[model samples]
Target chain A: MKTFRILGRNIRDSFRGVWRNLSLSLASISCITITLIVVSIAMILSANVNNFTSQIEKDVTIVVFLDQNIEEDDIDSLYYDIDTIQYVESITFKGKDEIAGEMMEASETYDSIMSNWTHEDNPLQDTYLVKVTDIDHIAEVAKEIGYLENVSVVKYGEGMVEELVSIFDMIKNVTIVIVIALILVTAFLIANTIKITIDSRRREIEIMRLVGASNINIKIPFIFEGLVLGVIGSIIPIIITCYGYAALYTRLHGQLFSSIIKLIVPEPFMYNVSLLLLVIGMVVGMVGSLRAVKKYLKI
Target chain B: MDQIRVQGVTHTYKSGVTALYDLDLTVEKGEFVFIIGSTGCGKSTLGKLLYRELKPTKGTILVGGINVGKIPNRKVYKIRRKMGVVFQDYKLLDKLTVYENVAFALEIFGLPKDEIHEKVVKALELVGLKNKLKMYPRELSGGEQQRVAIARAIVNGPKLLICDEPTGNLDPKTSMEVMTVLDEINKLGTTILMVTHDINIVDKMKKRTVLLNAGRVLKDYAEGEYTK
Candidate 1:
């Protein structure tokens, strides 16, 4: 019962402290707001980049062209050899006639040019479409398949896939670093603002000590006040993260620039980001207040 | 019973200046004693030591039978809660009203709200500031502020009340008004150890007086016998 009363008093005092030091409290809140906004943007960017990378990994496939004169028995042996390599997820073989038929269906020009070509005169090569388990090891898998008997050429957009993946990886890493740095900066900024508030109330703290207030009693209100400021500071960022991301996802039609580079769906993603913003605000606020209290207040 | 017992108490500041040299003193419960001396005579230092604000470099001091010097800094509030202290500057919280200032003392202890309200009102009434409960410290005069400080000090019903020049910032007339409140409280059975350099109050109160010179007890006077 007594503990509850003390907690109740501390909570009440925390609110009163914020109101009494409105300008200082607002300074702290605004600091948290601006930094958390940046942090939310970084988180969204990182999440979307990860989404785009995974989509690319899922869609990319290696195309292995067989020698035009290879015998059916040799083609079957080459397909079995390619399947034995590690990281080879699945492979589908397309006969030359089937390839020619696909080309004819794709365009009127191809249909007119290929209508007169019989199977004997057709020059298109039979190909194997290979998918790999890991995109990072796609090049190695393609090389192993190229070494197979009767294989003429191997292609999986070689250099372009590697470069795109590397760039996406860099973007994800930078965004993470940016998010962490912003949280630290917000904590430091709140600490200084709370320090000034504590400095202004030095005499009040002295009187409290003289009047028999324990150190815990003196510290709890200030810490709670910091927590309150942080939570308030995060409100705007959370709102922006939830609504802005959903709105952007809608405006961009679920993709950026093209359908190949897709955005994360808004459903649970925005809610998760909002939760993250709130937690960051709360933890940063408490840490900042604790630092100010420990360093500045003698008690 | 002795409310405060100091034996061979010596206090040396961190700057190497010795404030008190082997001082010994005692005040019985329900007794009112005045500690008077010239400036730099360590009268305020003694008051601070009694309240455990400054630990003696060498010696034992007991307040309400607790070894105050042995209590660690974190547990200092346990000893502080058993006694009250009034400062020369009044030290009323600027943000709190007279009623809230008095209520703050009880609030720190987590007393029930109704009990706090009752005690705050009674404490204010005793100090003759019941009508000014809503006034902030800045709105009050010197005497009223001091009375509010007194009310806060005694609100917890501490056995010992240490006043370190409660009237240092007041005029003579206001000083007497504040002194009257202390006298009334002392008569009601609270032990008071007041540190003051006010010659006029010392000459008039005629209570038990202890005079200090160079941090040593120069003279001790019984009630109705204190002289300049």
Candidate 2:
């Protein structure tokens, strides 16, 4: 009962204080909203990058080119042997004529320049396009395919795969650093604002103490005030995030990644991202208010 | 029984200025005592010492048997709960209404809403400001503001109330009326330790008076008339 009464008083007082600081409070809330929006954008960007990378990893494959002189039976058993590899997601066997046809189509522009190309004389060789369960196991899978009988060469974009891994790693590190810096900035801004407000109310606080107000009673309102500010601030960024992502997708629909890659950050991802922003907003507000109140209330 | 006891208490400020010299005094429960002295003679300091606002530099002082000088910092709130201190400035919160100021004490004590409303109305009535409950302190006259302060001081049902020249900012007539309100509250059994320079009111009251000069207790008398 006593605790409820105290909480009631804090609620009343917090509203009163917020009213008194109508302009400053609104300004602070706006700041919170804008900062939170930027934070949300960063979060969404990082999420999308993660989603895009994972999708690419799942679809990426290994291409094992074969010797032109390799026999049909050898090629047939080579596909069977490649399928035996535990890490292989699937295997696609391309014939010599199919490979030469694909090359001819690819080099169609060269036809106008060279004007002399035939499928029979095409240099492209048959290959096994192998998709692996784990991109991390790509090298081992490729090596096993290379050792197969009559396998002339093993060809996959191994360098591109490694580069993609490094890119994801670098992005992860940068995103973490940016988030830490943003959080620190938010905390500092909250602390300074609370400190100023505390200075203005110092004498009033002293009077409240004399009148028998408990320390918690005096502090709760200020903490709540900060929390409100933080919550309101985080919302602005969240709304902007949804709108911004929608705008990006509208422009990038057919221009950037393939339809499969486009499927990665669909509507559901945005929905979850909004929920993530809500959680971040709540925690930031709670933490900012707690910190500000603890530092200045001296309770 | 003596509700407050002070012995050989001395105090020095952080700036190294001596605010109080060896001082000793006592007041019984249900007593209305006037602490009289000149401007810089430690009368306010004594009141502060009694309330644990400022710790005594030496010797022991006790209020309701709580050694105020040795009270831990956090538990200072505990000591404050048992007592109320008023200032010459009528330290009612400007932001809070007259009723809220009085009810603030009850609120801090965690009294229920209905109980808070009851006590606040009762305290305001005691101070004769029942009609002005909704008015802010800034809208109140000096005498009315002081009455609000007195109302706040007593709303917690404190055993002790310290009035440090609460009437200093008021006119003579207003001061007398304010003192009358305090006297009325005292009649309900709250011990009051009042520090004042008004010899006229002090002499007329004929209460227990402790006269301090140069930070020391110059005289203590029962039913004493005030002179300087």
Candidate 2 chain A, poorest ten consecutive residues by summed lDDT: A110-119
The number of the candidate with the highest TM-score is 1
Chain B TM-scores of the candidates: 0.98, 0.95
Query: Candidate 1 on A71-157: residue-level lDDT in tens?
Result: 989988888898889999999999999999999999999999998999889999899999999888999999988888889999999
Candidate 1 Cα errors over 4 Å, as ranges? A65-101, A112-134, A145-153, A296-299
Each candidate's DockQ score against the native complex? 0.66, 0.51
- Interface RMSD, all candidates in order, equals 1.4, 2.0
Per candidate, native contacts kept equal: 0.65, 0.58
Residue-level lDDT tens digits of model 2 in B1-228: 789988888898888878788777878899999988888898888888887778888989989998988886556788888897888998777878998888777877677889889988988899899999999998989999999888888887899999999989988899889989888878989999999998888987889898888888888878755554
Tens digits of per-residue lDDT, candidate 1, B37-86, equal: 89999999999888888889999999989999988887888888989899
Model 1: colliding residue pairs: none
